[model samples]
Target: MPLALALSPFLVLGFGALLIMLAEAFGSRRGGMALGSTIVLFATGLTAAGLWMYGLENLKGLEAVAPWLLLDRFTLFFQMLLCLGSALAALTAGGYLPEHELDRGEFYALLLFATFGAMMVSASGDLLTLFLGLETMSLGAYAMTAFRKASPRATEGALKYFLLGSFAAAILLYGFALLYGATGHTDLAGISKVLRAGAVKDPMVVTSLVLILVGLVFKVSAVPFHAWTPDAYEGAPTPATTYMAVVVKAGAFAMMLRILLTAFGDAQSMSWSAGWPPVLAGIAVLTMTVANLVAGRQESVKRMLAYSSIAHAGYLLVGVVATMRAPQQAGASVLFYLLGYTVSTAGAFAALVLCGSRGRETVSYEDLAGIGRRHPAVALPLAFFALSLAGIPPTVGFFAKWFVFRAAVESGFYVLTIVAFLNSVLGAYYYIRVLVYMYMREPAVGAPVAVPMRSGYVVAAVILSAVMVIVLGVAPSDTLDVAVAAALSPG
Candidate 1:
C-alpha cells in the first residue's frame, strides 16, 4: 500500500489539525471549526475501520516503520476509540463554549491537535515515538486546561498539571534512557528480547520498569499519582474535561498496554510472585478505594466525576493485572471496558452540560435539585449515565465491570476481585447521589436552579453516546470479537 493509504487515519487527523489551525488564523467565522473537527475525527475513524477491513497485516511498507509506528489491529482499535471520543467532546464544546462565553476557533484547533497527539501515542511502537506522542498530547491538554483566561481555577489547574506532567515526562524519559542502557535498544521488542535472553534481573531494568510504570500511573490518574486529576478536571472547561477523562485516559492505557506487554513481558517480570502484577494490584486497590471514598464527599458534581474517572482506572488496572494469566481474555475485557467507559463518561458529561445554560450552569448537588422534574430530556440521560457509572444492570457499565471482574476471577485473583466488587458497591453511593439530587430533592427557596440549555450539538452527542451504551450493552459479542482480535501476545 502507498504510505498515505497505510497511514490514512493519522494523515487525516494531521491534515485536519493543520486545516483547523490555518482556519483559526485567517477566518472570522468560528462556528464551523467544531463541526469541521468532528467531521475530521469521523473521517479518521472511517479510515481506521477501512484499514481493519482491508487487513492490516497485508498492508505493504507497514513494517518499514516497524518498532516506531505499528499500525495493527490494536492501534486501529484505539484510533477509532480516540477519534470517536474526541468527536463527541468537540460536539459538546460547540454548545459549551458559546454558552460560557469562551467561544474561539483556536479551541477547536487545540482539540484537533491534542487528538492528533493521542493518535500518535496509540500508534507508537518505540520509546522515541511514545515519548514524542505523550508530550505532544500533554502540552495540548495543559493549554486546554487553562483555556479560560479569566478563571483563576483554570490557571491554577493548568499550572499544577504542567508542573507535575513535565516532571512525570522527565522521569519517563530517564527510565527510557536507563532501559536503553540496560538492553542497548529503544524498541520494545528489542528490549524484551534482551531481557528474555538473561538480563531480567538487571537492577537498571527493574528501576526502569518502576519509573516507567510511575509515569504511566500518573497519566492514568491512579491513586498517589492522581493528585492532578480532580483539580484539573474541575477547573478545565467541561468539554476539555470530557476530552481528558475519555480520550487522554484511553491513549495512556493504550501506551501502557503496549509498553508493559512488549518490553517487560518476560515471565519473571510479569510474574505475580515478583513483578508488575502485584504492584499494579496494590495500585488498583488504592485507586478504587481512595477515589471512591473522596468522591462521595465532593460537593461539585464535576469534581466527583473526576474522582470517578480515577476509580474506573483502578478497575481497568484489575484487568491489566489479569493479563499475566489470561492475556487474550483480560486484554479484550480491558478494551471493551474502555469502550463502555468512553460512551458512558461522554454521555454523563454531555448530560451535565445540557442541565445548565449560560449564567445558570450547574456545579453543586444543590444546583441539580428538581432538575429531573423539569427537564426529562436532560435528566433522563443523566440518570441513565449515572447508573451506568455505578455499574448497574442492563447498561454498558455493568457489562464492562462484569468482563473485567470475570477476567480477574478466571486468573484466580479472588481477593482482588472481591475488593473491586466492594469498591463498586461503595462507588454506587456517589453516582446515585447525583440522581437523588436530581429527582428527589427540591431547590432551596429563592435559589437559582440550573436550566436546561438548548443546543443541537450537545443533544446529538448525548444521543450518540446513549445509543452506544444501550446497544453495546444489549449485544456485546460483536464488539467483544473485535476486541479479542485486537489483543496482542506478550511474546
Candidate 2:
C-alpha cells in the first residue's frame, strides 16, 4: 500500500482539523461543525481498521517517518479506539453546546485537533514525538475545560489543569532529555538497545525512569497526582469530560506502554522486587483505595464520576503491573479494558447530558431523585451504563475488569488482585447510588427538578455507545483477538 493510504488516518484528521478551523474562522453557522468533525473521525477510524487488516509491515515508504512515528498494530489499534471515542464526544457536544447556549465552532475544531494529538501520541515512536503529541492533546483539553468562560469553576479548573499539566510535560521532557544524554538516542529502539546492552543501572537511567514514570502516572490520573481530575471533570463540559476520560487517558496509557516496554523493558528494569512493577502496584493500591473512598462521599454525580475515572486508572495500572510477569495476556487485558471503558464512560456521560436541561442540570443526587420514574428514557441508559461502569455481569465493564484481574492472578499477584477486587466492590456503591436516587427517592417538595432535554445528537451518541457496550460484552472474542494481536505486535 502507498504510504499516503497507509497514513490516511493521520492525514484525514490533520487536514480535517485545519479545514474545520478555517471554516469556523469564516462561517456563521456552527451546526455543521460537529457533523463535520464526526465524519472526519469516523473516516479516520475506518481507514485505520482497514490498514490493520492490510498489515502494517506490507506498507511501503513507512521508513520516511521511521523511529519517530510508527504504523504498528499497537498504533493502529489505538488510532481506531481514539477516533471512536472522539466521535462520540463530538456527537455529545453537538447537542450539549447548543442546549447550554455555548454553541461555538471552535469547540469542534478543538475536538478534531485534540483527537489529532491523541492519534499522534498513539503513533509516536520517539521521545520528541511523544512530548509533541502530549502537548497538542493537552492544549486542546485545557481550552475545552474552560469552554464555559462565564463560570468561575471552569476558569479555575482550566487553570489548574493547564499549570499542573505543563509541569508534568516539563518533567517528562527532562526525563527523556536525560535518557538521550545517557543513551545518545532519542528513538525508542536505540534507547532499549543501549539499556539492554549496558548502562541499565546507570544513575541517570534510573532517575530518568522514575521521572518518566511519574509523568506518565500523572497523565493517567493515578493517586498522588490526581488532584486535577475532579475539578477538571466537574468544571468542564460533560462531552469534554468524556473526551478526557476516554481519548486522553487511552493516549496516555499508550504512551506508557510504548515508553516502558520499548525503552525500559529490560528484565532488571521491570522486575517485581526492584523495578516499576512494585511501584505501580503501590500506586494501584493507593489510587483505587483513595478514589473509591472519596467518590462515595461526593454529592455531585459528576464529581463522583470524576473520582470513578481515577479508580478505573488504578485497575488499568494493575494490568500494566501484571505485564511484568505476563506480557501478552496482561497487555491485551489493558487494551481491552481501555476499549470497554471508552464506550461505557462515554455512554454514562451522555446519560448525564440527557438528564439535564438548561437551568436544571444533574449535579447532585437530589437532582436525580425520581428520575427513573419521570424520565425513563434518560434513566434507563444511565442505569445500564452505571451497571457497566460498576463492572456488573453481562456487561462490557465486567469483562474489562475480569480480564485485567485474570491477568493479574495469572501473573501471581494474588494479594494485589484481592485488594483490587475489594476495591471494585467498594467502588460499586457510588455507581449504585445513582440508581437508588433515580428509582427510589423523590425530589424534595417544591424543589427544582431536572427536566430531560430532547436532542437527537445526544440520543444518537448514547445509543451508539450503548450498542457497542452490549455487543462487545456478549461477543468480545473478536475484539479480544484484535487486542491480543496488538499486544503481541512490535513494541
- lDDT tens digits, residues 1-491, model 2? 48788789999899999999999999877788888988989999999999999897887899888788988899999999999999999999988999999999989999899889999998888998988999999999999999999999989999999999999988888899899999999999899889889778899998999999889998999999999999999999998999999999999999999998888888888887667889999999999999999999999999999999999999999999999889999999999999999999999999999999898888889999999999898999999999999999788999999999999999999999999999999999999999999999999999889999889888999999999999999999899999999983323
Model 1 residue 136 lDDT score: 84
How much does each candidate deviate from the true structure in C-alpha RMSD?
Answer: 0.9, 1.1
Q: Using alpha carbons, what is the TM-score of model 2? A: 0.99
- Count of residue pairs whose backbone atoms collide, per candidate: 0, 0
lDDT of 1 at 421: 100
What's model 2's overall lDDT?
0.92
Score residue 166 of candidate 1 by CA lDDT.
95
Write the residue-wise lDDT of candidate 1 on 23-120 in tens digits.
Answer: 88998888888889999999999999998998976767878888789888999999999999999999999999999999987888888888888988
Model 1 residue 118 lDDT score: 91
What candidate 1 gets wrong by more than 4 Å, as runs, is none
